[model samples]
Target chain A: MQTKETIVCRCEDITLEEIKSLIDQGYRTIDEIKRVIRAGMGPCQGRTCRMLIAQELAKYYGIPVGEVLMPTFRPTVRPVKLGTFAGGE
Target chain B: MPKVKETEILIVGGGPAGLSAASAAANLGASVLVLERDEKPGGQLIKQTHKFFGSKKQYAGDRGYQIGDLLIEQCGNNPKVEVWTNTTALGIYEDGVVTAEGRAKHLKINPKKIIVATGASEKMITFPNNDLPGIYGAGAVQTLMNVHGIVPGRRVLMIGAGNIGLIVSYQLMQAGVEIAAIIEAAPTIGGYLVHASKIRRAGVPILTSHTITEAYGNESVEGAIICKLDEGWQPVSGSEQDLKVDVICLAVGLSPLTELCFQADCQMKYVSELSGHVPVRNEHLETTRPGLYVAGDVSGVEEASSAMVEGRLAGISAACSLGYGEDIAPKLQAEALAELSELRAGPAGQKTLRGIMNLMDKGGAVC
Candidate 1:
């Protein structure tokens, strides 16, 4: 496993220090932390950062990792062209 | 006599838009009920493991799942809003009634106004072995890896370069899976340049003007045969490339779930730009069918951020139609229009705008 020092949340390029600050700010939930710091809204989505955030939130809240909720996946899971959708017509 | 489960408004879909709609209406002092098919709210945002772009007010730079949580908290903490999870809205009746099924029990309820945030369904492309066991939608892969903690495959061949395709390829890498390649029939990468740049930097080959013609596995996808396309999309001669991969992820596109709107007999039009046939909705997000409203992908295929704005508009629009704070609807409508316009600004938004224009032209209505 990569060390905890690796920058996971790329959108904000959030480091461990900033995430710790969010936890100190009473943002225990991943969602709350994200809203406060813009941690996960980059183009890569949360692919690289979600698990790490979950871990940090758990450590901060003193909760088990399983208690944390994951994000919902929607369709078009890849970027699709609108033109292709209408081509059938 | 039967407990009188009633609210001034009902919002279906439980996605970002649905949650926002409930929050928007409740904040306006209106009683609201939100129905979600999933065990929890947040819709696709829950599975989105990506960061978002936009302004701070929109939670730009937040992961999709985090946004889902914030919205859920905002909606859940409000006394005026009641959210039902694992509740499937079976159908939308003409008289502003919603039929839902939960725990194998069916129930019917009526609200003064309705907002259809039912979202859209994943589309599929027909190929010789598309129905094979290993073939799945890109969204499904996300659910498995990001949500369920199970990798979709050891090696994957992605078809499509739109945002979904590109993003998933990167995600598969994050999950420690190898991406053989991403194939798109278009001459250029379809999704955002930043997204493409990420995977490209990671050494994943994005083959444009190429497509997977067939999957060659008896019952599971073992490998795929890809080919380059001419201007007419016909496979050019001798352009075949074969890939060895366990999973084939289709990130083709989504089709709006406008059937409920159509069933209500709202003014419907086949707008190719809108992801499929959609209901003709006005500035207030109200469908032509007076009390009926459509939000999120069902209105048109847009992101969760836009869905939130549209959801707020739809909820406010519905609340106004129900005779609750009717005067405030116009102001809310204007704000939503402005927000949506801003969200649609940028290079990637050009195609979306084009799609919306096509939809508007087909409906012969002003956007």
Candidate 2:
């Protein structure tokens, strides 16, 4: 059987129909959609796509929209050169 | 007289956003240079193996590292783009100048336009024994397992049920580590139900409304004491439960690395909604300081896709400011704005958009 193709957020690589199907299956949380679709798992760490998914999921669940759990930041928030991180002096 | 190296655009990050910006600018025949801090070009992408979601333009359905490889290839194919690995951009100066020191040489460049696609880092909470040897950040664990062929610990106690916590828990399991349980301070799981369910079906109990009050063990993490919390995030009495574990992983949140922007005297505002104090920039991603632009998480914590869009806009804006071209500015801006609008269309983005709008309405720096 051919898998249905759906693009969620072009930015984060999430699918549109995949998200809709997941919501139909009762996966209501934005976090749920992220795992299934890898919505906010990109390098931007879902900075852009996460909110879009959260709103979509909220609407699908028929509940008041809520905040999606954002990923935590690490040190050297900017991509630091390994040489810089290792103290290239 | 003096060696004058010239590039139309300087991108100061090799992550997804930075690379995308470079490709976008190079596609338009602009000279672009990408400086990455890591030994390898791909930032965070090297460790991510899962497929992406979104449009074909975003390269949806591909792994992050694969996308990075494609960007590297694209950069190679285009002579206009130059990538300098193992290089760190120390500061952004006035007039679009970027100061840097790499493994072999110290250099200064005054690119007409620059894009600061510096990404955000992982955030960890500090408890009494947080500094223990075995205690690691969730990202650290990922790097250890995904990047390097090593395991952080045999048994782990993951704190925070958000995506990082849940996904890392599953990864740890995949790496053959025993997960005691996933503990979260919030009343609900912060990550996706699919991730939680993946772990749940694998028999990992997710203890929501609970937190790691303290990590036990002197030398390393021998155990951790978890407890239920009230709605206000305070621990409840007599609900403490101790579990034997060897490692404690923190996946709390992230804060923008605006030290460079702050040092350069860019106007900043502290909005809890956007993670922390970020540079106050207009729609073009230009900071209050002329010629200084911010993108990726440094602007406001968002995903790589938005970062890429923001980075492209910032690059084009900087290039146009430098007389590269102005005809494509409106077209590029509209496309980027559209992509940005789509990314922020969901509920999770509401508060962040509100934060930005509030900052924009404030009309200047918060502090």
- The candidate that achieves the highest TM-score relative to the unseen native structure: 1
For candidate 2, give the lDDT of residue B71: 71
Cα lDDT for residue A10, model 2?
Answer: 43
Q: What is the iRMSD of the candidate numbered 2? A: 16.2
| CAPRI grade of model 1 | incorrect
Give me the runs in candidate 2 sitting further than 4 Å from their true place: A1-89, B1-5, B94-96, B363-367
The candidate scoring highest on DockQ is 2
Residue-wise lDDT of candidate 2 within A7-64, one digit each (tens)? 3354464556567778889886766777777776665445545545655766765654
* Residue-by-residue lDDT tens digits, candidate 2, B12-70: 88887788778777876788999998888767777876666557767788977788788
Top lDDT hit:
1
TM-score (chain A only) of candidate 1: 0.68
Candidate 2 CAPRI category: incorrect
List the candidate 1 regions with Cα displacement exceeding 4 Å. Answer: A1-89, B1-4, B326-328, B362-367
Number of clashing pairs per prediction, in order: 31, 42
User: Where is the poorest 10-residue window by lDDT in model 1 chain B?
Assistant: B1-10
